[model samples]
Target chain A: MVHLSGIKAQNLTEKGVKTRMKILETAEQLIGEKGYYETSIAEITVKANIAQGTFYIYFSSKKAVFDELVYQLSSDFRYHIKIAMEKEDTFEAKQRAGFLAFFEWVTKHRNLYSIVQQAVVVDEKLYRAYYQKIAAGFITSIGKAMEAGECKSLNVETVAYCFMGVGQFIGMRWVVWRDQLVPNDVFEEAMEILFNGLTHKGGKKNWRISRTGYTNEQ
Target chain B: MVHLSGIKAQNLTEKGVKTRMKILETAEQLIGEKGYYETSIAEITVKANIAQGTFYIYFSSKKAVFDELVYQLSSDFRYHIKIAMEKEDTFEAKQRAGFLAFFEWVTKHRNLYSIVQQAVVVDEKLYRAYYQKIAAGFITSIGKAMEAGECKSLNVETVAYCFMGVGQFIGMRWVVWRDQLVPNDVFEEAMEILFNGLTHKGGKKNWRISRTGYTNEQ
Candidate 1:
């Protein structure tokens, strides 16, 4: 279900690979900024510094290029996250690392949010595929944690989607909207909610009481 | 920042209001299905069985109608959630009710996911406003819970976004994709994860072990 490589870049010369990369990058920027419907193939070709016919050599149509861009971006981020997760020993630590990797990748490709959201309108199937692939990865790692008794035995698919939602919304609020790295405090608070749940468990001090001047009765 | 009523909807006669609603409803169905750019005003009017000039009575442009549709949908769901939350006494129960209200609302307005997503491209500010309005409501409710010590004392905004993410992804996974209500077990599992955290504490039996035939050592 996952295609790890570009659409037509296989068996290409070094120059052909570069040209293909150029086209994909250009499409990413234009489509990311102007949107799919508003962006024209001519604009992509001009921005890519390639002839119109050259685009056809790499992709059959505008939608084809857009699909490849989504695929490449998904693969790139997942690879980075997988590498980051490998450096951690425990499931919680690995999950945290994976999230950090996602934020870092999104910081570099800020257009990722825009492009993926645009897919909802441009191609609904592609949009679903993008998240389904991410959820699949999460389900696998979370399933392992459950087997090890390191995590709760909730439905694997449900947990996977929940985790994806956290990563996406947190990234959207801090990185995408503010154009800044998620502050450490915000990240820790999110982790706290995910790990400890929102119910006050009595042992820990109330963090917001000191930080936000909220009075706690107990 | 929240506009409870529709744009330019004030002081209209009963017949005027009905005509206006017809335009918004038609716009929602078409935009939800074909997307914003692909769906034309002419098509909306045709489907609505109204004259082309009649659309101008309610909206100035296609974008105007789209903005109103977003506003109307946001208002509709928030109103329903507010009523649902009011019926509950505790913060946790209120939140659970809110999620239920949102899910029920989305079941009827399935195009909501697509239309709001399209706002990411059609009008970024409107898209942001949509979630921000929803977040504002969440923050107010969550803040009260934190103050009363019913919830953890983490950053209010962080908690708000996390809750929003959970609602959105869970809804998208079940209601939007599958075109069915979120199943009872799935709903209960989500509530458990939200209320109790995902770490398996010592007492409760592992639910998935029995359901999936996986043996748990502990």
Candidate 2:
């Protein structure tokens, strides 16, 4: 396989890099509006103010541009996740905080999130790549927490998948197809239940306090 | 539009119903052995010991039978869910029971589950029909629960979508692409976390301990 990272290093100058970002950003926005199948390279070129051939020069096809857009978005998603994890104190708080940060980023990059969501169900290569790229990091974080006796000691992969299952659902429901925002606290509360359990375990621990700063009653 | 349900209503002969069931069963088995795209009307007819003309007489085209199959599957899924809910004691238990039952059925019917999952993501009209059909019932349930004050009042549409979203990712991760079976308890635990959340002062109250008698704590 021709490595894309290598191609980017060789083919792109700083100017080319800027153009590529613009193209990807534009493609992401258009895909959000028209979906993956409806959006075309011509529209992307027109929107990016570049030649159709130039679009090809940077990426092989519309799918390639899409893959790259997801690649960039996921990396950025990880960066933001890391940032939140660092800022928080405990591992549990970090997981919750990182998820909230990731959710917020997805809210901002609604377009990218929609495109990736569609890709997960639509294409085989995209589905496998998405799973490979996103799942490992998630499993590792949860695994580390389990190992350190911070989180529940369940099978890490299953728990990781459980978290992802819930996260993707939230992104689709609250971010893409909805009219209003689901409050951040609501999301945090949900995460608390997911990671912790719903009952009053006598640990006023590991959950978001409601808007009134009152923890939910048993 | 031509209606298969109408034909079923019209058929009074014992032979007619038996033949119809035979054809459907053969088609279902063949679909598992061979994929939807690869399985043809001719092959299905031959396998069922029916004539080619008879096949078309039963269903209009390839797409129609596929649609009917999925429609039936969706109906069955909803039926199982209703049964689960009706049997459960508490509201939270009802949701958990319903979800576990649904997921368990999907697990048992892996090939059928995959066929339906692919229909939603790969085919446009099929996807819409599948989504809308399932969404309608879920919307009603959420609306009822919200009105009854059984749960937190939230946007019914977004909440329904969110619920489906969780199912989608988990289905793909654990059921479709999964190399090994992720056990029922893992999914049960996930659902518990999803329904009640960890941060609530009432810790275990939101969860319905499964028939397995294990807490999803691990």
Candidate 3:
């Protein structure tokens, strides 16, 4: 809830904003690779190819800069998801698009997982706030779906976390660990589990036979 | 797979084993509370009421003990899930039980999230191995369920991660964050989403009707 836009709002020339962003981007990459504890302002400035004094002009300190990066990461992610979801016609489509956006964004910003996870240790409040922000986005959309009879009448918040968790674990498993996009079949299977669940359709069938030649009856 | 069982395999008396376990328990507690880098062997030994020199007899160094603790946490968790799942007859029931076991276990072992997450920074291999071990367990069981026509025919590994992700996020949300058992209704809702998905019954029903007195069509 703190107003942390990652840059000073007042008295900023266009070039100053650009320099500040450069410093942040450099910090994000380094912190993601080397870790927050190991990274320093000097390193960030060096990587940004700016004077150490220039770094101070954009941020107060190393911790301050780190906080800004966290704020930006969370904001940027939600923005991407929102934009991706807007292109979809239905709620389900929107949800899928949102997930795909997350994966694609993470693929480019590879340090996201590392940096976010580190927030747990570096700043617990920031860590919780990051997920809470994302959950809020899910809650609003899921609430709408529940109202329209598209999603089950379960607790919306619980469903939000469930959806978030599934995306997170799947992303970590394939994207982060394997350094690849989630395979199409894998993504589809996960979505099926999310949309239709593991249960078979009606007593008419013993199990849902997916294209992969497996039977599922949740 | 790399045989990271944590402690050195050496000849020891019953008392030595007990002593070693005491050290591990103390270390697990401290590391979980304070983090791996912040915790030290002296603190663990002192907490365990053993001599600092006694530590080397059981483990080689601080990292060794940390690795051992990670191994134990994973093993103990699988054991709990297996035992809980055995009480259920169907795969679906087994999964619910497994998730319940996880939530219960994490509730009791509050440091679980921190400790396992810390492994990402402390030892990336150990962290990956931890999840991989859990996934392997799920894969084997889900594979069995698929063969028996009790579950859907999807990519088994993807399904395994999906299940893991759901349980983890759900647990993290309710048990870890809230410091309470997942409310029965909340748990049931999540299970419904996992087993039946967000979609409502039959093609006639476009989306599920939530008990929250709303119909969803997303």
Candidate 4:
């Protein structure tokens, strides 16, 4: 049986499992196309070809289904990245694989961005948990790499957030917005900045204090 | 005269300007507090202490006001970053100042994240325009720095997006989420990764190909 948080899925029969998945998938499509407030439970039921009563059998309320959709999408993408990263030996390769996996997965689930973004207001805690969960995975991998001297020693949390930001914006720009795979050169350039710093070796010593009083380098 | 896009603000008297500002401010607060769909025009006018007719004098519809709020906020934050970046001499210093300015600005307008995220559903094009405008600013600054040999030469657009992602995530994590100024150590560490890159100097040569076939380094 497929496990879903906060839902009793273990006792679900094979047909019951399919019904629940249908409900979630239908929610993803309707909520993704229409803003959460604009989509009605009745609309979801109609599109899913399930009775209104059947919908209630799976989800108690619209918010409940939305929360589950966000949770499921988050888990799905993280699982993809994990599997991709597992095939790599080096930290850098692992990161690259993870990014590639993310882009590929998002391409298939284009509504992932809209559904997730709506969570900011739909349920602020759920939105935070979505990113925090992803960031936690990054923190663990980066922390291990740092301990092994495979990467620079910085605040793992900060670096994890940075990694998350890069992956998200790149995916949003190329995959979700343009409906295309991230171009090879663009992917390479992002990795270039990720694996190596942006400053040319010769320019590394040029850090300076600005008039605003913030130090540019440690 | 305070300039506003899509609104004829220059012709307004001082009172007209104030009323218009009031409407936008009220919208920001309401839309930021409650999701856009939940906030009504009547509630906005009531909170702004203006009559329903007075609200229509400034904005034609709820979406019009919401769009204007997003435009104004985007312009405001970009202006802050621009002024901050202008105070620095080196590329690194300028970037640091820009980030500091962003965090400071977000602290004041804690709703910026929610308001912008809502734009994804309220108006997709506005959402894209918001990030594109910021990226354009980064691209211009980073392009000039690259030509002057202040930073490494890479895809300027990709680097621009990277810079934006770093600033945004750092701000979202610290200023917006924590409701505290980004701690000094965290700020410095993010700047370190942004300017120098995440991999250590010694690990620069450790790039390798994984089973997934993506290159880790250029």
- Which is the leading candidate under DockQ? 4
Cα error, candidate 1, residue A137 (Å): 0.4
Candidate 3 per-residue lDDT over residues A89-127, each given as its tens digit = 677878887887788777778778888887777777888
| A1-51: candidate 2 lDDT, tens digit per residue | 112244565667878877788888898788765666667888999998999
Poorest 10 consecutive residues by lDDT, candidate 1 chain A: A208-217
Q: Which ten residues in a row have the lowest lDDT in candidate 2 chain B?
A: B209-218
- Candidate 2 has a DockQ of 0.18
TM-score of each: 0.89, 0.66, 0.87, 0.93
**Candidate 4 local lDDT, A1-218, one digit each (tens):** 12354456787887888889888888888888788999999999898899999988888999999988988888888887898889778888899888998988888898999988998888999999998999989999999999999898889999998888888898888899999878888888888787777887544453454332433332
Candidate 4 lDDT: 0.84
TM-score for the A-chain in each candidate structure? 0.88, 0.80, 0.87, 0.92
Per-model i-RMS: 9.7, 11.9, 8.3, 2.0
What digit string (tens of lDDT, one per residue) describes model 1 on residues A1-218?
A: 22338445567887878888898898889888778999999999999899999999878999998999899999999998998788767787778778878887787888888899888878999999999999999999999999998998889998888888889999999998899777777887776677667785544332221221111112
**Candidate 1 vs candidate 4: which has greater DockQ?**
4
Instruction: List model 1 lDDT by residue over B31-81, tens digit each.
Output: 998889899999999999999998898789999999989988999899989
Candidate No. with top TM-score: 4
* TM-score-better candidate, 1 vs 4: 4
Model 2 lDDT tens row, B13-70: 6676556666666666665445455578898899889999887766887667777777
Candidate 4 matches the true fold with a TM-score of 0.93
All models: lDDT?
0.82, 0.62, 0.78, 0.84
